[model samples]
Target: MTKPLIEITNINKSYQNGDQELRVLKDISLTIDEGEFVAIMGPSGSGKSTLMNIIGLLDKPTSGNYDLEGQEVDSLGDQELAKVRNQQIGFVFQQFFLLAKLNALQNVELPLIYAGVSPSKRRELSKQYLEKVELVERMHHLPSELSGGQKQRVAIARALVNSPAIILADEPTGALDTKTGAQIMDLLTDLNREGKTIIMVTHEPEIAAYATRQIVLRDGVITEDTRKGGEI
Candidate 1:
């Protein structure tokens, strides 16, 4: 059998709020194979975001194991985890999360800068990704200067700059209207068809329908895992 690109094993996480202990995740386990488009759906406080964070290595689980491309992530130090995050994971958030002061080119170049890529190389690569997202002409536009769709396109370019193993998007369409959201979903679907693994967290069933697989989480555990035709 082919190994999974992403794996989570009995993961658990909780937080302390003043004198209270809130259990955000309770023994969640999941696996994502290569070239798959998966969506996670849940209500508020259902721990979908927490699970996404652990998968992206943005935060450590309170307990249990996680493996990325067969590397035991739970055993990695902070620096190692940072390296993994930079090289393997690309994130897109609902809020665009662009730097207000930086133009599209510079914004997409941020990841390369952190990865020790030279200035010349950063420009070249950023331009390539910008063009892929069809935003090369708007490279000089600030986030505020772009419309909702354009800004999200720039965000997608930034997410692709690193050629990451998987794209993790949290409520990627939450901030957009229906028409714009469908356009963004089509872009994502096209990307997945070209072999990028995408795992998105969303509450809308219409958004989740774009993915080949759907996992429903409730009360911090997966309640159902469904797949489309031709999917395993």
Candidate 2:
């Protein structure tokens, strides 16, 4: 059998708030196979964002195990975690987190720089991903010079430039208008069809509809896990 791309088992997370312990996630178990597009949906405080952070290696679970590409990662040190995050995960956020000083191509090349890719190779790969996202013409434009949709496309291109094992998007369309959001979703769907594993967190049902599978959370627990057009 082909190994799953992501395996998360019995995970939990909590934070201390004054004298209280606030649990953000509880006993979560999930598996994502390669080439699958998964969506996570929930209301505010549902722990959806927390789960996304753990899955993206930005945070560690309070308990249990997580494996990425068959390698255990829950116990890695901070530096190692950073390395893995750089090499294995690409992140897309609602806000286009592009550096204002950098142009689109330069933003895309940032990850490659950390990965120690040569200058020529970085430019080549960044340009290819920009082309893939249909942003080749805006390659030299700064974030402020692009439209909202164009900025998001530039962000997506930056995410793809690393060729990471998975793309973790959090509320990727929250900042766009309906039409622009739909265009971004269509772009994501195309990327998933091309075999990139994706896990997106969104509160919008229309946005979630683009995913092959949907997982809904409530009060730090999974309330539903279902495929598109199917019951849990």
What TM-score does each of the candidates earn? 0.96, 0.97
Model 2 score (lDDT): 0.93
lDDT for each residue of candidate 1 in 67-118, tens digit (9 for 90 to 100): 8999999788999989888888898999999999999999999999999999
**What TM value does model 2 have?**
0.97
TM-score of decoy 1: 0.96
Off by over 4 Å in 1: 230-232
**What is residue 179's positional error in candidate 1, in angstroms?**
0.8
lDDT of model 2 at position 58: 79
Report the lDDT tens digits of candidate 2 across residue range 153-194: 999988888888899999999999999999999999999988
